[model samples]
Target: MARINVSQLKQACVDRGWLDRWLDDPATPVPMPMTPAGGIPVNGRLFHQLVAGLVQKLCVPDASAPLLALRSREQIWALLWDELAAAKVQALVRSQSAEAALHLAEALKAWCQRLAELRANCPNFKSWRSALLTHEFDLKRVAIQVSDGGVVEVSGRPDSVQVDPVHGIVVVDYKLSRGSNGTLDLLQLAIYARMLRLAKPGLNFAGLLEYYEPGLHLVPKTEAQLNAIFEHEVQPVLDRIAGHEKLMSKLKSVQVGHEAVRLSWQPKAEPDLGRDIEKAYNSFKVPVQVMGRVEAPQLVRYLIRPGLGISFAKLRSNAVNLKIQLGLHAEPLVMPGSGHVIFDVVKEKPDTVWWQDEVQRAELTAHASPLALALGVDINNRLILADLCDSNTAHALIGGSSGSGKSELLKSLVATLVKRNRPETLQLTLIDPKLLTFGGIVENAYLTGPILRDIEESLACLHLAVEDMERRYEILLAENHTRLGDRIAQGKTDLPFRVIIFDEFADLINSGREEKKEFERLTKRLSAKGRAAGVHLIIATQRPDKDVVTGQLKANLPMKICLRVTNAVNSQILLDEPGAEHLLGRGDFLSQTGSTPVRGQSLFIPQKEFLELFADKI
Candidate 1:
């Protein structure tokens, strides 16, 4: 029998959808496939060596030893620098490449900086340092046989393992790569835990996946949990490999007559079938081989070569191009690094759930307690409810091109606010230059004044809002209160929450120099201090150019909702990121209230439904 390591096991699981097929039907026999012999990338090997060397030096300090106790931070830094320089020299000697050495040197500097930051911020730094010196640990390669006669052997070289009597054996593996932890890393840690448990049955074990880039990620897993994963996920796959079954069929390649082949796909009975197919094909920069077509309606299939599946990054790029060409919503379903892709044209818009839905109404009615605002359904089809006071009351900036569903989103937001609160509790100041966007809600009694359509009237309304904000602040100071919410809670004055909706803010800003400066001043003041006074602004614009959106305007508005835009530049201007350009239109948008952006599909409210909901009030 041959010896197998955790890497071999992981490769077997990933080769040609074998694991997915086995999980789908465990009784079905599958061939015992050999793991492909592929060389690890040069960068990967270097990262491994760097992590191992750092762990051996930094994580194994001995305080009781005279030489180790005399070491200061500067001395430790010098030692680390020397080790890194030696590693770089070794890499250059082996590869004869200066580029590789330079890369390694830069990585070492980054790792050193990260370590210093960790030392400064970690609360348990003292205890952690003490434990490093006192704990019994091993940092060497080990092999263990799982079954009798060595039918199954698993070998791994853990970065570090500390044997603590209180916390059992702690296995730590380092990941130098960026991004969130993946399944393979977790599985490798679990395998290490399993190997340790098998080698020393009396001792308990725990596993951790640690990263030393950007920040620290210390992920710990219990021995029982790891054992359970081994039993359910790892053991079954191993048993099947031992059984030896037939191999799964490979994907068939299509023969093309021309050097460049153009394939067309049409969804049956779909009105926009041709348009959708054109957009899908145009999305790819390089021509794709159309393997075959599926017989399902509204479905188009394309064969992706093995190990050549489109990644999310590539998909986002393609989506940006498609948005520019088609100017319509397109949702492509492709798993990162899969063997195939499907472009399904949505036949109709997603069904609209009424405000009268009992569950939805109940959720809305309960919003008074926390002052939460129901945004809409997210991309995952989950209801997105956010606290206005917490997430967006400071201010909001919205941007999208024409036909990108900005109007619909604004309408949905207003409807949500009105459905939940009475006129006495909430008031809206709506400004629509087009006059048609907010016409449906003009008759609502909650309006601070009838939706302002004239430019002068709109400007006056905004100025009044600024004055109102100042008055609220003075009231707070006089009452010895810090915030409006706090004043309201103490039963001071029942001033309704103010939400000023500015549709087509670009129109107002582009009106003249005077309007632009005045709007900028009032908006800056409101955005800076309005959240504490319970005043929020929701401003929308079709043009997101620098001159129109302006730096001063964006600096004030912290919460941004960006629908599909024309290009990456526009997307960056709107959200300070490039993802908004890749948004599928028709209210598919990215909401950025904090550092990370949340993707969601804005709720759609048909005019008929809107009229029905506000019939008596309007």
Candidate 2:
């Protein structure tokens, strides 16, 4: 058990993947830069004192001056200065004899101007004329029990609380700096709202960010949004803090350097690919020029400019010869286009992209849309995300042959989805016929049901998805909201996005005709209307054929991820054209979010690490 503040809890959850650090040292605050615009230095203490003095004089209710009512700029400044002097705020700012003192004066003047403009321009400010305001609201110690038989006594002091005509009890925090930290700011406000709700169960509490800007740039969040923030972003950190000993023990056993199958590798240098391409072209007398090249963890692409009057078809016809001359295991890929003929060659020693590194590097937050799926990194080292919220990428069809890392991709998808979102916001229905794909998975908080192995159970799971979609649609119609997100914003926090990850879809559909038809009907219905209802499907298979992936199914699943297929026919079956057959195996994949396909390396998380990371859930 430990005593902590809302700010400390927020810092612990700043990196959700590593909350154990907070248990080791609870007093240290997360560091933030204090520099203002134009490279001007700032004294943090002085700025806080000035802002506190201004807010006390202006926002708080006073018998002399009105509450949040606009006065002449000069009059307001005079009042604020008087209040600060009477309070004896700080000697540094009182002297006004140094650069820091000058900066504080400029800041105070800016605040006065912004306040004036806000009062005159914003309708909400006008409405707050009769609002009841409380400054420096204190939250006493509240003990919350954790799973590890420990209690955490949480406390905080929010800047202000206002009861307005429109929004009920609102917890407000003032931000005077130009820079913004979306994660920290939102967490602090949400924590305050939670504390207020706990104290006054009858009052509806919301969160607001009143920043220093012209015309009152206010960021208001509804009650449901705050609840979600507390559950997803705040509660998990508290749980980890309580159970840090067990988690740290598991983490200690994980040998991060164990490399039976290295999931992270970067080659020192790329093979002499440009020279090899020149030699290949010389043998064929095609007169092609190597314009440029781009290197990635999995593959290196060499951009070629054919000699004047050389057609793209001519270079495409020489792909086989080039592959043989360069001694490539996979076919040399010449993507379809009328522009310069780009050649993609697999690396001799391909790199294995690890999920742990990418997750930290991206600095992803749990507050992001639950449907945002991290689809590895591209050759340009950019994160490839497939937002299931969009129509085009609502449902996906993933195809690969043996040794194509199809199972690894599925594992990564499931792991990242659960890692980045809360169980209350995201739920998963895993249908693994192979069992080998998700065998390591156990009962977790994010699961909609147990890992289903039988075809009948899998179909039943899909049927439930269809039914859930219909029920949600009814809710939308009743609420007059077109999207699930809109309904949730209206305080319907119980609804979560349901994602169905079907491993070896071909096996499920290759059963009897009755089952196949039933599965098809359920999948097609869901795919057509799932995005609006917050339901998504990720169908993966090693068998890419007409039997498993039908025309109707392909039409609905526009987004496709194709790995190293057996032949061009299988590749064409997945991508609506050929090219995937030449993909470098072991996590190399091409995702077709739009018309064209882009190559990327899928992240690989070892089974041992995944189990260790989610041991509590299992």
Candidate 3:
């Protein structure tokens, strides 16, 4: 079925011809050329990314200095320009041509200058900062499925959402265009306001279009106007698109047994995968026979028995060549053994490992380990369990890029942890700097305390954990117990296994050098000695860089769980390898117990279901 973007809806509202043209030639690009900056044409996408990053950073400043009103123009601009040097943003800027960087830098300055002018005319920066909620937020949170055809996601991020004293909730969209008279601009703002209203009902939303001009042009649309826009303008377009998509689907559907048929499951394996593998090996002068393949949720493992006289090293060296020859998106995992070479290929339609099903079938016995976590299912569809009590799996370092299912994996891990053990046997310390991931299960009985949100609170939580660890050690020493597990095994249920799951660990470290140092010190001490004291750290970050996941931290965290990363370098930072870069996002993961990395699909539970599951304390 065809997906409809909010932008398309906006264009359709303005002129249905635009939507028809887009549907006819979806691949056609719009003809608006970005203005030249620094002798180079500005990349619209990159410019938006830079602006979005700055807006988000500005809106959600550090908790220590939450007031944007206090900062001078110099400080604000410094923050905006300094953000370019950030690892994630820097990667984006560096990937382009050197001239692209100059273009973005100049474009950013121009954009920020306009922004400053708008802010300067505002009545109160303090009020504005206080009213600000979020920026560059994902619109998928409020995506609505259109007649089972496709999900309609508001494709663009709304500039800002602020609660006004008199105007109520204002959904703000900043415009760089010379005029806000354009139909699409007004519709875009109206659609975003509608999305926010849908996501959070009962909140009155007003669409405010702010243009980048010398004078303030805060055009506010009332709730009645918003409703009119959605019902009169947006709803009609959506209905037409739905009808069109249905027709398209009917035209595409295959008939079988007097009914249009839909396949229950489609295999992701390339029809000529085995043949391609053989062809690749043959090209490298090492002919191999396809033995068989083991199909799993996320990937397929191909068993290739090479012909005699083909050395394992020779075959290993041609891994890259195999990837190229096979036309693979990522470098396929090629393991050349004594007799057979294993080729693991990712699938197009990766299966989901549902949370309830996995937990119901999981082997959660007290005799196994004090902190047994059902990580995910391996290639053989077998439940892969890791005992935090074991030295090799004591601590874990999880890394991934955005939309890589890193957050979902964390939630699954949390659910598994809580489900596997009783509240007395396990306690959780969840620190989410973004204040998003662990909110659903904040009231879970297994939580040691409330979910830590800010850096100060998180640092304090870690400090307290360290102190508690020392006290536990003292108790262990007095009782002549080597480890907490031994004590717990002896029916000492009072000593629960404390698991400190820190999500967005990069945010805390990246806040400042002092904060980073303190975090490192606390985590280092906990990771090194926390195991014996029944304390374990599971630190996760989207930005897996050397600065965030340092060498010392990596050494302590032997068990690495890596999801899809942006590059080989990021994958290497987490797993000391490059395979993670090729992973299919949304729960496709590689878990390294010690040195051997096992690929698996993580169990997923949607936010609503997760919240319901842990709604009443456990």
lDDT of 1 by residue, 106-177 (tens): 555554554454444444444335323222244233444332223455566665565433355677666645
In candidate 1, what residue range of length 10 has the lowest lDDT sum? 243-252
Candidate 2 minimal-lDDT segment of 10 residues: 15-24
lDDT of candidate 3 over 322-415, digit per residue (tens): 8788787767777542246778887766877788777665233322465767787777665666668766578899998898898888888888
Which of 2 and 3 is the better model by lDDT?
2
Which regions of candidate 1 are displaced past 4 Å? 1-66, 69-371, 392-394, 401-403, 440-445, 477-482, 490-493, 564-572, 575-590, 593-600, 606-618
Q: What does candidate 2's lDDT look like per residue over 1-618, in tens digits?
A: 467788677765554211322455464445454464455444545555665666655544443436444555666667677767334335555554356555555566666664565455444554333343566767887776564567677898887776644566688876655454577889888888887877777887888886643223578899999999887567755654555545445556878786463224465586768877977887787888887888888888888888887777778889999888888876788874324577888875568788887776422342235566778877666556666775657898999999999988888888877776677778888888768888877888778878899887888788888889999999889988878866665666688878899889887788888888888888889998998899899999998988888888888786899998988888888887888888888989988875457688898999997766557764
- Per-residue lDDT for 547 in model 3? 93
For model 3, give the 10-residue run with minimal summed lDDT: 28-37
Candidate 3 Cα deviation (angstroms), residue 367: 5.6
Candidate 1 global lDDT: 0.60
lDDT for position 535 in model 2: 89
